[model samples]
Target chain A: SQKIEQNSEALNIQEGKTATLTCNYTNYSPAYLQWYRQDPGRGPVFLLLIRENEKEKRKERLKVTFDTTLKQSLFHITASQPADSATYLCALDVGFQKLVFGTGTRLLVSP
Target chain B: GAGVSQTPSNKVTEKGKYVELRCDPISGHTALYWYRQSLGQGPEFLIYFQGTGAADDSGLPNDRFFAVRPEGSVSTLKIQRTERGDSAMYLCASSLASADTQYFGPGTRLTVL
Candidate 1:
């Protein structure tokens, strides 16, 4: 069976530091990977997307790295703030306009 | 422009009752999707529609669940004989195309007692 795994269920980081979240998958090769941030009682919002051929993508203080060989993707938030605290999800494009998402990892940035 | 929207922000129904959840996609978006998210879990795909046709319904859990997109704009998800296990947040999303970024709505939280 295909599976997607995040390194941890919850992560706590100090403010002004870099927070890295990891997503690993097995038994699938996706053309693209996406990251989303979701807050309490709300829907998730798109953050960034990286294609298989591209190694890294960045927007402002957010960065994402895709390693196809290892079937892993890393999401990094620099100079993290409490405002960035939320559950982060990784989605794999399963072709034909479908996406399979991992359980997600909750991130907490402490003051 | 307004993003996607879902009706009945919350619904509480008894088991075996029928329910309908509605979704209004963004203007001119050609692709729309439905997903279900449980507590502390990521959204799970239910179905996808392109224009007025259902492009994929593979993720639908069973025959008791169905969705339709009429006139290529609004869609509805219908559930028959709701059960306690059916309780979850029903999400709706829309995109300009299959490969485009999807925007989600506030979601309809369903609770079956």
Candidate 2:
């Protein structure tokens, strides 16, 4: 069975520190991967997108790295702030704009 | 600018009853999609529409689930003989076109009792 996995446990880090989240998948080849931030009782907001051919993509304080060979993508938030605390989701384009998303990892940046 | 919006932020229905959830996509968006998300799980695709036609309905769990975009703008997801398992967050999204970034709505929480 195909699966997209992310760390279910909440990650805690002090403010101003860098936070890293991992997304791994099995049995799927995706051309494009996207990251979104979702707050409680709200919809997901787009953050960044990285293509398979590109090794890394960055926007402002957010950066994403994709490794097609490993079927993994890592999301990083530099200079993390308390406002950055939320569930971050990784989604892969399964063709025709259909997205398969991981469970998401909760990040908590405490001050 | 207005974003995608879903109606009845929350809905409670009885088992075996019928329910309808509405989605209003952003203007000029040609693609619309429906998904269901359960607790601790990512949103699962249910259907996709391109210009008022259902281009993909394979994600629908069963015949009981159906969606329509009569004017290629506002959409409605209809569920027949709703079951407890149908209880989940029904999300709607739209994009400028196929393969483009999708903007999602806040979702409609459906509870089947």
Using all chains and alpha carbons, the TM-scores for the candidates as numbered come to 0.98, 0.98
TM-score of chain B of 2: 0.98
Candidate that would win on DockQ: 1
Q: A-chain TM-score per prediction? A: 0.98, 0.99
Tell me how far the alpha carbon of residue A75 in candidate 1 is from the true structure, in angstroms, after superposition: 0.1
The interface root-mean-square deviation of each model, in the order shown, is 0.8, 0.9
- Per-prediction TM-score of chain B? 0.97, 0.98
Q: State the local distance difference test value for candidate 1.
A: 0.94
DockQ of prediction 2: 0.79
Query: Each prediction's Cα lDDT score?
Result: 0.94, 0.94
User: Which 10-residue window in model 1 chain B sums to the lowest lDDT?
Assistant: B94-103
DockQ of all models, two decimals each: 0.85, 0.79
Task: Please give the range of 10 consecutive residues that has the lowest summed lDDT in model 2 chain A.
Answer: A38-47
Error of 1 at A1 (Å): 1.8
lDDT of 1 by residue, A21-81 (tens): 9999999899999999999889889999999999999999999999999999999999999
lDDT string for model 2 (B1-113, tens) is 99999999999999999999999999999999998989877888999999899999999999999999999999999999999999999999999884568899999999999
Distance from true location, Cα of A84 in model 2, Å: 0.8
